[model samples]
Target chain A: MAKTIITLGREYCTGGRYIAKDVARALGIKLYDKELITMAAKNSGLSEEAVAASEKRHTHSLLYSLYTMGNDLPLGDQVFILQSRIIKQLADEGPCVIVGRCGDYVLRDRKDVLRIFVYAPKGWRLAYGKENNMLQAKDEKGIKDEIDKTDRNRASYYNYYTQNRWGDAHNYDLAINATLGHDACVKMILAAAEAKEKAMEG
Target chain B: MAKTIITLGREYCTGGRYIAKDVARALGIKLYDKELITMAAKNSGLSEEAVAASEKRHTHSLLYSLYTMGNDLPLGDQVFILQSRIIKQLADEGPCVIVGRCGDYVLRDRKDVLRIFVYAPKGWRLAYGKENNMLQAKDEKGIKDEIDKTDRNRASYYNYYTQNRWGDAHNYDLAINATLGHDACVKMILAAAEAKEKAMEG
Candidate 1:
């Protein structure tokens, strides 16, 4: 079978991380999140802490951009280069489910990449955030503000780097609303990913 | 067959208009593009020119945005309201394929709507633009520049209104790369639309 990589691009507090974990365990495959930066740092002579600190912000780190663009930043060119490199480095490490960080466009057109974007409604995301301790362990208003802030940061990072809006649905092979339940989201995505790989094989 | 509405969210040069025409002919349904503006304008009591002028610009003009945080200038909101109304009105009138102006989110959750997004790679889009007289008869570089600018405006409009990014891929039920050839795209999407409608009925 061809090496299959499943990348997850998700909305904040949508249980994207949780679902990714479930899918990885279900498939008996390694999962990636902050771990990607560690692998990239190790393979690319960068630091692990540096990778974590940067995370999605790594898409436009000046030193990396300079190396790619040959000189000073020229408007939008740097973003593409940074995103391209980050995506390449991730794909280079072999098959894994990457949660967010524009792995879809980075590996766009790769026959082996199965890109998934996970999101749910506002009510569901807020509930998930509270349940997962993503907020300050508070009620609706408190969590809503935090969720809004996180969603904005996520959107900005996605927009700045990929120049595409995050969670737009068309960018992914499968878009799931985890509000139905985490288990349900995992089931649907696993089905899509497995079938995609099988189809690729035949 | 029950009435089916096939909405077209297209790039400026992807032959979405033509494919839509083909779909309407094949399915014997109405097709709406810029023409819907007149219908919306009539229904909303705005002038046709005003509707067309605001066709895809969901942003308040620069001056309007400078004055407030958009609580006052309902220009952007107004465009969406108009688009949503028109989309619903069309759906109610019977099946139609709406092109552009954030129709997918507008019709989302509708038991009947099969939203689609059509896209092509840079080279293919440029070629389509030139072939379709959408490129202002420019050289490859010039056409590329125009395509970039046009898409930026489109993404800005879509992002602003839908709170979702244009061409993001995940938002649509079906997305296709039209670089495969216009007729092929038409055939595949027509089939997809039919299949999707069947699923919805089931």
Candidate 2:
């Protein structure tokens, strides 16, 4: 039998990562984040650094890049295809929580997958970033620039690979605000997941 | 003839107001913001200050507040009812842009209404707040707190009056990132509005 999975797509500094961790723990399911890099590296025969770097920015012109490279696939394409396979394989093996990597689009056809998008207002994210030292930049302007740049890259990557718009609520089973705090967000997601499961059964 | 109205719901510091203004200018339509308070105050027989105060906080009890005050209605109920009427009247009168006041829900049944939600990543919002001096709070933390609190009040007010979840994509015809800058966002909204109009006609 196939296992049910939950795929989370989140905005930067939105507590989406924390929510995924808590949700996975609560549900007693394996959670995949950076681990997907290792899986992709092993599966695609690429180095871990290559897999990790692909997540940083969207590579332009698969055709031009691929033609020049001659048999070496673009890191973005390799990571996406291999990691997508890993995601499917993990789902087939057991219930799991997959964070980011466009898993929502990857598992679009799966009846057992529950896709969620977690987001919050910008002020909340900014405050969280400052309090946690999650940001690389020291000053507020520099920090904001970094956050904006990172968000843009993520959006570009997701848009490049996915059929659905990133962060659009209609693409997911549920969309929540992480600014409500991690515990509250986790409870809400769990409750929503339960509701989705029951609805599927009913 | 009915007007083609666009209602914008947005996150604080997301430049939603600027987008609304630009959209209104592009469409050559009236933009309702503080003006709605004037309309509600005039119609509800409440002072402008009362209407403005009601906008700031969610009224806890309409019936209880009304009963205790003897002659006064709950600010929430009064504002909601009066503003809803004014929204409808504005739409009926001519094409206009309405921001907040749950204008989408207010005109949910109207064929000519276009609902849009504008959002931006948190860091971008903080930057915008700083650059424009739009935030009353001097420090970053204070600004963030005010933004969060104001958002909570807005969400409570919207959720209380509307059948749909505030900020949920399903409730909107279009959801956009204000980080695209005002001009791009305005163009996108205008294009979407035209597409919607064409769909209606076809």
Candidate 1, residue B60: Cα displacement in angstroms equals 3.3
Q: Specify the CAPRI tier of model 2.
A: incorrect
Candidate 1 CAPRI-style tier: incorrect
Worst 10 residues of 2 chain B by lDDT: B57-66
Which regions in candidate 2 have their CA more than 4 angstroms from the true location?
Answer: A1-3, A59-73, B1-202
Per-residue alpha-carbon lDDT of model 2 for A62-163, expressed as tens digits?
A: 455567886787666777777778878878888889998888888888877777777765776889889988899999899898889878887878877774
Tell me the tens digit of each residue's lDDT in model 1 across B1-202: 6366877888878888888889888888878885665566567776645555564544644344536645554444555566678778778888888887678877886867766677766776887777778768467777778888888888877777666667765566556555445565566556556555665565
Predicted model 2 interface RMSD: 14.7
Residue-level error in angstroms, candidate 2, position A172: 0.7
Q: For all candidates listed, what's the TM-score of chain B alone? A: 0.84, 0.86
